[model samples]
Target: MTRPTLQGHLDGWSQGDDLRRDVASAVLALAAAGIRISELLAAGPLAGALATVRGHHADGDSQKELDVIADDLVREALAAAPVALLGSEEADEAVTLAPAGTLAVAVDPLDGSSNIDSNMSVGTIFSILPFVGADSLLQPGSAQLAAGFLLYGPQTALVLTVGAGTQVFTLDRATGAFLLSEARAFVVPETAEYAINGSNLRHWDGAIRSYVDDCQAGTEGPRGKDFNTRWVASMVADVYRILVRGGVYLYPGDARGGYAQGRLRLVYEANPIAFLMEQAQGAATDGSRPILDLIPTHLHQRVPLVFGSRAEVERIARYHGGASAMPERSPLFGRRGLLRA
Candidate 1:
């Protein structure tokens, strides 16, 4: 496949002018709303209190900062045309639409909220799925037609798609528009250079532990390749790294309480990331299940996340496989066979 340079991709942005207009407008809206909340935290008193829980936020507590930001962004994003329903991770119900369009956007308005207090990078992940059939806001993940995420960081970038290829757009401060950083038909590498979080080794399942063990062993392990590990405690940061350089990023389940399912929400985190992975010729899964196939049942539903380079992820899935699972075997000796007992 012919690979296009970043500039070449930017030149093609005119092709999807309509979406560009809608999404571009949404960007401004996001900024206007983001500035409001980010400014709030930037002020006194509350800032000091939030800084206490900078890296880690206790669950069931007041995430008021996140709540306001999410509500604002969702309200603004839904204002765009072709948006039918609004589903927010922070909201208790699926917001209905007028008789406009049948497109539904599921948004994680404030992802990595804990990072907000610490001045760490956070992001907004949204999946634009079909709202035509079944009329279910609690529908399956397969219904997604498009997905994207906005990283509010050093160099804020927007990664999005509408079923074609995923594209990365950087916010050009001077022009106040998105300039393309990557074009259609991008390729994410097979072997990974980095993985995440290994300290939970004792609590991890045998499969997860074995996978990391192999990577830790690197070239000496089953696969003759060097590897690295990194964990930023922020999904946006990890994803940005993987997108910039090719690597596998995982947030899987361990025996730890509240992590048995997953830490990140499914509707926002997994769905959008899954879309981006597939678009970039990478992969996304919940260990054994394809992320796009799962459905959301609760407001803040969580699921295992394993995505990035295709081959490495498939291998990880093998270890995760049990009865009636996908491909069920890790390449133990660089060959397609069952794991040695």
Candidate 2:
């Protein structure tokens, strides 16, 4: 049987509605840009020093050469689409694309650019929202009309949801088309796997540290089951793995100096990912609160992200709320545990 193409799916979804049609158009544009980026990434070093530091964002995150290039590519792709405002991680402020357009797009043109030199998986995450006026781009994640990500990995793939269900499509290099792979992807509610940066244990709050400690304790602990840990240091790669297999992922805010709010951007990163997670029967939160319900105060605002299997995500929230058992600290060491600074 022939697989349904992304265009076919979008065509059926839009039917003849003006807004849906424009959304479909914008999605196609993003896919086009993803294809180009996939080719460039496949070239590796042949594409020049893509990992070279280009500059720095106001938050001090290093801007990479390929980051800028990907931003340009995506912006160029959306130019002809019905996009009124473009909120991108690479841009300091939202850019006006089509003053009269009815859609606004928030995008992380190139996520995980640090993995460029290492040939690791990276991706582009996008959130499509209705243009509602000056605050269009600042709306909460709950207002998203559609959200998705293009993973440029061993096989380029697109995982998307348009308020229906999440779907996975893979690029057929020979046909140059995205073909349906998983029609209605759903996240498993329970998991024995998790992803996190274990090195930050020292900086983590009692809740995060307690959760990880319990997981690591295996069958001898509260969970009563062994768990495997995975961390790719790339949100897209890690989240994709959890979406496919049963697992949980956490990038929680710790006591570290510039990381109190977490590192991922709320609009382009967490929001889009949260939307996809919820659509796939998973869950996402900023520790104790739903990610989608949180209103964005600014475009580049960061938020702690914890998502994946619904059971695991809720358990995490319990940990954050102090309802879960926390590890004990010895009196000799006090609150500043001997192992922690």
Candidate 3:
């Protein structure tokens, strides 16, 4: 079957709604930005120079050269878009772009910037929300009108969801256009693979530790199934793998300094990724709770993000719930003392 172009797929939708049109336009703009970035990345020498750290972003992360360029490119592309406000990880706060516009866009213009040095996969993530009020930007994922990620991997692809379903569009380098590669992409409900930073096992909370331990135990453990583990460190790469196959990815809260709230940003990362996961018949959560139900207290609020196949996600949630059933913490001996008591 001839896969439809992204624009064609969008065009097939009923067109009376201004919001829908705006979203379609925004997607096209993003596609344009992705294509440009992909081409630049193909130029090895230039991309290497662009990978140099220029400074640091508002979030205290190292600001690479490509990060600045990509952010500017996306910002410019969406300048005349029907987007009222722009929220980005690189920005200190959300900025009003078009006061009369009805959509607000939150984006991680270049996620996993550090991966550029190693020639690993990196991508851009975006979430669209209604611009009812400034506070609407702080709304939960359920309030999203659309969400997507533009992955600049071996092949540039855009994974998007507009409430109805999730679809993947691969960029045709020759045509400079995104074509629908997967319509209503479905994720298998279970798998023997998992993704997490196992090095942080010592700092991880009981729930995450227990879950990892169970997986590590293989068929000899309670799961009665052997498992394989992988961690790409880059979320877009990790999530893309999960979407293609089936596995769980975790970036959970831990005992490390400034990590209690977890590492990944809620607005730009968790919400948008959660939107895609649920649409694909997958699942996403922050340990015991659903990621989409989280109310954003801040624009760049960090949260523990765990997502993938529904069964695997639910199993991890059960481990979290089991932790709650354990004895309460104590001032004298902490979790250990409570358990002993």
Best of the candidates, TM-score? 2
lDDT scores of the candidates, listed in order: 0.67, 0.91, 0.85
Give the candidates in order of TM-score, highest first.
2, 3, 1
Winning model by lDDT: 2
Model 3: lDDT of residue 240: 91
Name the regions of candidate 1 deviating beyond 4 angstroms. 1-67, 80-82, 97-99, 133-135, 185-187, 323-341
Write the candidate numbers in order of decreasing lDDT.
Answer: 2, 3, 1
lDDT of 2 by residue, 1-341 (tens): 89999999999999979999999999999999999999999999998999999999998999999999999999999999999999999999998999999999999999999999999999999999999987898899999999999999999999999999999999999999999999988899999999999999999988888788778767766577789999999899987898899699999888988999999999999999999999999999999899999999999999999999999899888777653344455575233211110
Cα TM-score per model:
0.78, 0.95, 0.93
Residue range 53-101, candidate 1, lDDT tens digits: 3222335434545555556756764676556677776666667653455
Cα lDDT for residue 167, model 1?
Answer: 80
Candidate 1: worst-modelled 10 consecutive residues by lDDT: 332-341
Model 3 misplacement above 4 A: 322-341
Least well predicted 10-residue stretch by lDDT in candidate 3: 332-341
